[model samples]
Target: MKLTKEERIRLTYQIGDIIEQKCRRCYYNRSDDASFSINICAKCPTGQTLRQLGRYFDTEPRSRGGKTGNMPDGLTPARVRELNDQGIPDKEISIMFERSPSYVGKVKNRWRKHRVMARAESGAEEVK
Candidate 1:
């Protein structure tokens, strides 16, 4: 089913998240309060573009392109070291932990600088 600009924008962002509705021509008319309805945002850029393009328009939140997630819990430094000590490859460990291989490698690289890690590399037990 087709969605209106208000519906699409609402799907992408809540009314409170649309605080930065800026345009030189429509700046004064733009709604700044979360109290007002989405229709008050009609003068904003997305609405203006939608006005010009009609159904051919495609819109997504401007900030959606950036990396915007928190690191998942449990993939701690101790956990990573324990996984590395288990003879698991970084790729497999990453898959098991639901993290990227590069992130796992980065974690391992950061941990490698510890003197205990240096000793552990020579068969001594790692001190966490």
Candidate 2:
């Protein structure tokens, strides 16, 4: 996953192309579905991902200008996933995060939900 500087620059340009060509229509068009409705670009998964990538290239972090010093782990769902990927148990993650284990479980669900949302997919896969 590590990329050279030139690769990063190329990737950023590619993402710009995708947003301009593929994701632009979704941003400007209206839709009956709440998930894809107009003005939902703020919540667009592609935009979210691009913004995250931009952060890596920025010299300074942008302050969200929200209330500060909240949550032990900054309430990042990705951190939860990172711990999970390390095969850490939910209970341990919860204790480290100073949140309830059930809350940790819910974060996991939300993480998966956003992932599915990003794909614009429907119809759950059936598992036997």
Candidate 3:
């Protein structure tokens, strides 16, 4: 299908963004062409377009071009405890643990509520 002038311009900008992101976060450096190369195609022997290259890599954070960074590598129990001990905020810790920051934040919030409830119950017992 033929693309209109506007479509072509949009497509070009989209492709350029993909290329830049890929270059920034490329995992495999099989060849120099795969990374740090100004022109992705010139390095690729298969003649794949920038769009195709985006598929080979993982997605980045907040990327607009339908791509994202690599899958998160969930947090471990030991690491979670370590983060708690360090007094690291749940959201920041979650990112380090490769889990959703929101999940960590929710867990922290729940713990806070539980502590408050326990304290209230204890206070009532003292009054009685």
Candidate 4:
């Protein structure tokens, strides 16, 4: 599962592109100067992704103030998958559970990885 340097760079750029697109849709304000600030809503998908990817700096002031530091106690991986299966987008699901969208995305990603691993194991069994 280890990625080569070039693969890692490519993945990073792709993620950045996705984040940028989401930010643009969310009406994030970007400044031209180096000392300028990029103002984004705290609950925005772009903000969440940037924070998760470690591209967000602590010095930047958020438009929506700060994180409330409240964790969704009852949200589990199964619950997330159920919501997603029911046609709920990750952003809406996160809002419903009072969590960051990146958290929901991570949960979904984990489930996907689990399913992929399970399928691989089942295929191996079939080959045997």
**Candidate 2: tens digits of C-alpha lDDT, residues 13-127:** 9777766655656644444333322232556776676677666666555688565444564555555556768999888888886877776676557556667422323434311
Model 2 misplaced regions, further than 4 Å: 1-72, 116-128
Instruction: Please give, for residues 1-128, the per-residue lDDT of candidate 1 as tens digits.
Output: 46787876765554233333433234445434433433434546656554444443344434654354445566655565577689877788778868776766765675676564465556665454
Q: Stretches of candidate 3 above 4 Å error?
A: 30-128
Candidate 4 lowest-lDDT run of ten: 119-128
Residue-level lDDT tens digits of model 4 in 1-128:
45567866876887668656565445544433332235556767777766665542233555784454344675655555567689998899888887676767765565466674344334432110
What is the TM-score ranking, best to worst? Answer: 1, 2, 4, 3
lDDT, candidate 4, equals: 0.59
lDDT of 3 at 56: 35
Q: Comparing candidate 2 with candidate 3, which one achieves the higher TM-score? A: 2
Q: Rate the local accuracy (lDDT) of all candidates.
A: 0.56, 0.60, 0.54, 0.59
Better of 1 and 3 by lDDT: 1
Q: Which lDDT value does model 3 have at 11?
A: 71
Per-prediction TM-score: 0.31, 0.31, 0.27, 0.30
Among residues 3 or more apart in sequence or in different chains, the pairs in candidate 1 whose N, CA or C atoms overlap within 3 Å are none
Question: RMSD, each candidate, Å?
Answer: 13.2, 18.3, 16.6, 19.0
Clashing pairs in 3: 59-68, 59-69, 60-68, 60-69
Best by TM-score: 1
Question: 3 or 4: which has the higher TM-score?
Answer: 4
Residue-level error in angstroms, candidate 4, position 29: 53
Report model 1's TM-score to 2 decimal places.
0.31
